[model samples]
Target: MGLRPAHPFLRRVPHSRGLRRLRRLTRRDPVQLLKQLPEQEQRARLLELLRADLQSNEEIADETWQMPSLTADGRTADLPGFNFQTRVCDLQILQGVSGEAMENLTKTCRLLFPLDGSSWMPCTADPRCLAERLAQEVFEFHAKGFAFDPKRSGAEWWVQIRDSGHSEEGIQFHWDTDEVAVERHGVNVHPHLSTVTYLTECGAPTLILQCRNSLRPSETAQVYGSLAGGTLSWPKLWKHLAFDGQLLHGTVPKALAKRLGDLPHRFTFSAFQAMPRWSPVSCHAGRFRTRFGRRRLLHEISCRLPHRSGDTTAGTLQLHWASKDAMLGPVEKGRKREMVSAGGGEKKGCLKGEIH
Candidate 1:
């Protein structure tokens, strides 16, 4: 006897309390809410509600977007240096759409897993129109001297709605090597240029650290300097920022992660331009690995050291790949001592360093 199919009315209901809360949060104008609160309580309440709502939602759990990978050759000498450059200007090109329209687009769009905890979905905005304008701006910035052809190079365009939370604890410092695509095909096609258009101002400022001068790239041209660190803020809504993809950048420090966890409801539209040829070396991972070819191995180094302020109590220093599917092992002490990936492989290393 064949089993009968379940009726449509008998289908399981989606219990996404987090998604519902998110919808409610976005539906109301944050500016009006802030205005309604007294000045003294505004800051505290804003932070509180943002954090509480996000924390309450089980669907919006924090997860790292990318983890650092080791090179196949085991030589870290060729690693790409950190060079972050920012340009602030009016995004007149994208002014065609009204702010309300953009906000609505961000709110109603579907959310897809970014392979990281940061869920993302495509935007309703026209990808081709945005790409064309961005390409024109890039050309104007270089005075027609830019070698890469946006159209001829087969640049891929996308408008994604990204939602990240305090659970992310600020993404670990990493680069956007377009590793997701490369791993799928095991090919070198990756984004060389990345542009971010801020749709809303809801999170902590992104902290960009400069790679040490000793680690600067040996070949090719580099922009920005080898400074220690800098913070990028989105003071106004609808501001656009573009930067080279080959940079070692991360979010705020661990100290401020708690306070900024849910304060910012980051909504952004991003575009990625691909390179003409694939390079064997990746900015984040030392060498590219193809999916289904071999098991990709990651090395994690952890150590404990006293605080830089001369405190005797030891603080753990963790250097490991951030996994999307890894189940963390129990904490032997105050820190997570070990992590086991979904694949069941285990490896460990140690490194001692002064914590400042």
Candidate 2:
């Protein structure tokens, strides 16, 4: 079987990927070049724009999101039952994102991943889209060389919102887990990485457990629990956390989900990413070696096409971070355990820092 990428307009072409890219780049009109400035001037102007954006991006992040500038302790917290190491960070950087950005984001979420929606929402792979840009920055800075292949990557995002009023809808312990897609050449799949970007903070503390999904391809959910992982609470408005998607995790104890009487509505933006189309992940080793020889889906994200309802292949195609268009820089440090000082002293039982 061959690789079928998650793009409505993309198809596996039996040609030299390199040659195709060269042709696209060189097909430019020579007549236009004569009317424009020399190549050196173009290169210098491009660098100027990049440098200017990079400098202002941090300032914009501080003002726009209003997240704290806390630094991470840099210690990887060990999940008890699993072999993965997770680190937390404060991702406070973005420039030129207008105040309406959040409004646009929530609007998209409601349109795509409704509050009562059951199916995961797919994102169009536009380099200009906010979600695509943020995901690219996160993966580049935080993926830390995880075992991901650029060509086979898939992405899906969803949102979860709970009003401050008491409710019994808190999540229980679970893994993001794998499932089979219904596409023509569908296969088993799981998100290689999962992320949570807090849009608003309440008293809810997300308990990331020490368990990882070791179940077989056809296996069902397994029982999991332990105090070996870590607890993240008191999130800054825009704090971000990431970890192995397969690890067992949950937010707020069922009993306390409703009793945080003084907090704002809980809203979060989450994404499952880098999920290659295969089960038992090792299957990738053999598939990549044989199919399409050395071809790759390099232009997947940059090409914009008309979207179709029947195209379930809609997912992000992140441009390589090394490309000239990377807009945000890596966060300086992961957020440290936050301490809430009241009256005269720090709150006695704030969740301990996950740093080991």
Candidate 3:
């Protein structure tokens, strides 16, 4: 079957007029048009851009393997500061994924995202789509087996591409708190876990923090209290790494500070949270299911979190630091911000924000 125009990014043009209009648009060069347009307009989900680049098509994998964990594998891999030994275990890295599957998935982004004004897009993949398969498989096998809270957890995932000009300033640290899901429930919460499925080899190392927002409320008026945990660094390519989302994480963006040098872009399938099923946040994931159908899904994840991106607060604490060694400035006790990281014996970027 031919590709359908169900998404703005994958518009199906029929008829002499529509085809002619697209031909005209494509003729002028969509990339140049995107650069010239206003930021808001450029960010819009544009059929023209999608079609131009794609006409230029719209757009993965097979193999499956799960990392060894105490629950499923009887023994997990060794990472000095990683929480592989946590009560239910806190991290898992998947390997031996089918190259065919990822190639197809990356095809979905290659032409459009780089040329479009935005670095990311809100999208859903069908059961046949690799993204759906990746998320569902992880939930059924690893998450369920490792004790990820399903009632309060569903995957919030996206396929991301990192530009070569990655910045140290771009990396911010925080925990993935789903406070909004339980806002009406009257209790605070965080994503049960998180995962990253790599489409490309390692670019920059993601700093998985030892710190997290405390599930317990602050006893004193002391805003936040932190018991620093060591750090874990370095991520291998073609590996799937899953960890407790409540832990803080950020990446080493500067290529100079990282092993990767001179590469232009990096790709990965990332999940910030696996939200509660009943929350409005989970409902945001529905658009993809509605469009793509039910063979598999990302538990209906909305690309953006409901909370603000402002200062770090109780459940949402943001850390400003360059590299892991760089001193982490104290987080201001500001209003709640939405976010999601790892391990270091080095006492740095240690922050366990308050619950209320």
Off by over 4 Å in 2: 1-84, 92-96, 115-124, 144-148, 166-169, 181-189, 217-227, 253-356
Decide which is better by TM-score, 1 or 3. Answer: 3
**What's the C-alpha lDDT at position 311 in model 1?**
16
Q: How well is each residue in 1-356 modelled by candidate 3, as lDDT tens digits?
A: 00101111111112222223433665443344555778788666355545555454321111232221222221122223334321111223234546665455565444333342211112232343444355555554443334322332334444445553343222334444332322333322443445555455445444454454444322112213332332323333444555565555544443333322222233333333221112223222111000000121111111111122122111111222223222223333452553211121111232121111
Clashes of 3: 21
TM-score of 1: 0.37
Error of 3 at 33 (Å): 24
- TM-score of each model, paired residue for residue: 0.37, 0.42, 0.42
On lDDT, who's better, 1 or 3?
3
**Alpha-carbon shift of residue 31 in model 1 (angstroms):** 25
**Per-model CA lDDT versus the true structure:** 0.30, 0.32, 0.33
| Per-residue alpha-carbon lDDT of candidate 2 for residues 1-356, written as tens digits (9 for 90 to 100) | 00001111111112222222222544432123222758787556435534543444331111222111111311122223431344445443443457676555454333322222122112233433344455545545444444433443334343555443224223333445322221221222334456666555543445454445434422322321222323333333555666666554544422332221222234333333231121112121110000000022111001111111111121211111122211111112443434221110011111111110
Q: After superposition, how far is residue 259 of candidate 1 from its true place, in Å?
A: 6.6
Clashing residue pairs in candidate 2, if any? Answer: 72-334, 80-210, 89-334
Q: Please give the lDDT score for candidate 2.
A: 0.32
